[model samples]
Target chain A: MWRPLAEAARELIDLCVMSDVDEDEVRAARADVEAAVARLRKVRRTQTLGQQHLTGGRRRPWGNPVIGLRNPIAPPLQVSTDPSGRAATEFHCGPAYEGPPGLVHGGVVSLLLDQLLGHAVGAAGRPGMTGTLTIVYRQGTPLGDLRAEAWIDREDGIKTWAKARMIGPDGVTAEAEGVFILPRAIRERSPSSPTGHIG
Target chain B: MWRPLAEAARELIDLCVMSDVDEDEVRAARADVEAAVARLRKVRRTQTLGQQHLTGGRRRPWGNPVIGLRNPIAPPLQVSTDPSGRAATEFHCGPAYEGPPGLVHGGVVSLLLDQLLGHAVGAAGRPGMTGTLTIVYRQGTPLGDLRAEAWIDREDGIKTWAKARMIGPDGVTAEAEGVFILPRAIRERSPSSPTGHIG
Candidate 1:
């Protein structure tokens, strides 16, 4: 589906080229098609029973594996769930994650935050998935040896909030707040217990 | 693999069925395995093959798509070559990109900036992909109406700097600064052309 659109945008450029359109005019048309392509590229097919693709982005209209990816350079963190919420992990970034020649890409910071925050949520008691996560990138993260710290911030009846920070050798590179949810069924499965009243 | 981890975590939930382990001890141990499971899940086998699964929170490794994009949700911005250094058109984001239920997802904001900045490089008489993009989400972004403005900020031969701002009905939801980089070959491809002056 996106291929034709890509071709159409390309054709529009060809059209502009044929019209002896000045550079400015050609660009105007080109930008229009390009913008549309960008918009269309993001739409996913509806989640029908027969659909092989998932609900959203992974169901990229064109099925282009590369574009379907979120960040192309982030590495997943590995940690041991030491029978308590504590764990340690490390990962390295390759040139693929580089920005400014050697600096780490900022999007990668947010990526790490989600992973760590999810860990924090799981540690807190209610573990499922992130409903929302936000980040503040304070400084440029060096491409190598980045470190992340995460801890449970608070827990509500069914939702748990966590905070996480990513640090590079220079200093803190990013901070995040995340909301991790425990589906209702998971909560119901628990027997009556005299612990922190989840309610 | 992830399923077993989830099941194990669920089984270890300090259920009342296990009276042997002290309540406090069971709780602590359950916390431990859940945390480990969370980290382990980040390494999706699909993702290792370069398939994207998450959006807004984590970005994939570099050379992958923008972060948190488990699937396609936005359209692509098409681009055409130009000697005068200008873009094809403007890109827009609308209701389809809602985050926070009604606001735009932070990752969606970053994705738009990435696309616009990538286009800006071409408009600046250079062609490249986004090496790094940093988006500062100022406030919650309204879902219905939004506009994105991007243009080349500076060009240092193969490296082009671009800036993008996301405008909401009330004000700016976010702004981004990016580095767009042309591969060495692409920068050297048209050294003989009129725009070669940039090289």
Candidate 2:
């Protein structure tokens, strides 16, 4: 995937050199690359398979909540939602993901926290932004098979308190706590995404 | 800097193809690449200068801390100890770091947060592993002249709290909050890094 981008960059550099552009042009080219990448920030929400993870949950589920991945494609390892408060995604990590020997990169784990906690804020039936997120990595996590979950703990007007985690093959590997902020832009419902008790 | 590593990888693959060592050597060469990467991670820690930042008051610092990059050879950043219960850094986000039009990538913002916050934990004069760090993108951040600061917010025996931020040309572009766990190595010094007073 990065190969095509590298090829494009090389071509752009070639074009810059051929045209004898100034340093300002080089700076402009860098902006062009980032502008191109910014487009990927938008996330596409999938139709709910109608499948649900929470089913009359006083019983509670297995493992710890602090460290887990929700959907595999959930890059940003985080979550995204419309106004309904339901978030979705899929993600994967490979060799580049490793941190300490067999351990996954700690920074990547935080990346997931930002992604999922942001989702939880949206799940609280509000379209908002992230105010804060805190995570705890309890132990080394081996690669592969991650689970994620998020829910609102509290909400006050624009502030939504939420939590999420990535449970690895070794069980609860890391967890997070956050405050999601619903900015004024779309704080109210879209009429399309109705409110509900969220996870 | 990456040229030598790339060349070494190419040479190893070529050598295995030309010699009669067997297919196992190809596997060995791949392992070599992995080992090389591990070495890079080990050396990665030696890069920081000032360790982290602090507020000393109950109030969260009104704005993001502007950290200074003290080490000339630091890899875009470095961490060093500050006796007042704080840590700081200075780094340059070059062409390799862009995620938005003329701005640094969001992930990079979080990366700086993790590093600064770790130093914040270190500021307590105790070395604990990270449990969580949450980042909020307040506004778009440009790629150059980035400053970061981190400091202890509150602390108990096993749990410590801290906050961080990435400041750039535009202003305070990001804010972060973290919870860190003291590994026994540093937890033992808990008596020194109290919540109300700066170290």
Candidate that scores best on lDDT: 2
| Model 2: docking quality category | incorrect
Best by TM-score: 2
Which residues of candidate 2, in runs, are more than 4 Å off? A1-84, A88-90, A119-125, A151-156, A187-199, B1-76, B80-85, B93-108, B123-125, B132-144, B152-162, B185-199
lDDT of each: 0.44, 0.47
**Model 2 residue A25 CA deviation in Å:** 33
Instruction: Give the fraction of true interface contacts kept by model 1.
Output: 0.01
- What TM-score goes with each of the models? 0.38, 0.51
Candidate 2 lDDT over A21-93, as tens digits, reads 3444434433433333232223221211111122332211111111112111112233445453445444444
Q: Compared with the real two-chain complex, what DockQ does model 2 have?
A: 0.08
- Expressed as tens digits, the lDDT of each residue in A43-128 for candidate 1 is 33332211233333232212211111111111324533332343345666543344333455455455555556655555555665
TM-score of the first chain in candidate 1 relative to the native first chain: 0.55
DockQ of each: 0.03, 0.08
> For all the models shown, what interface RMSD does each have?
22.0, 17.2
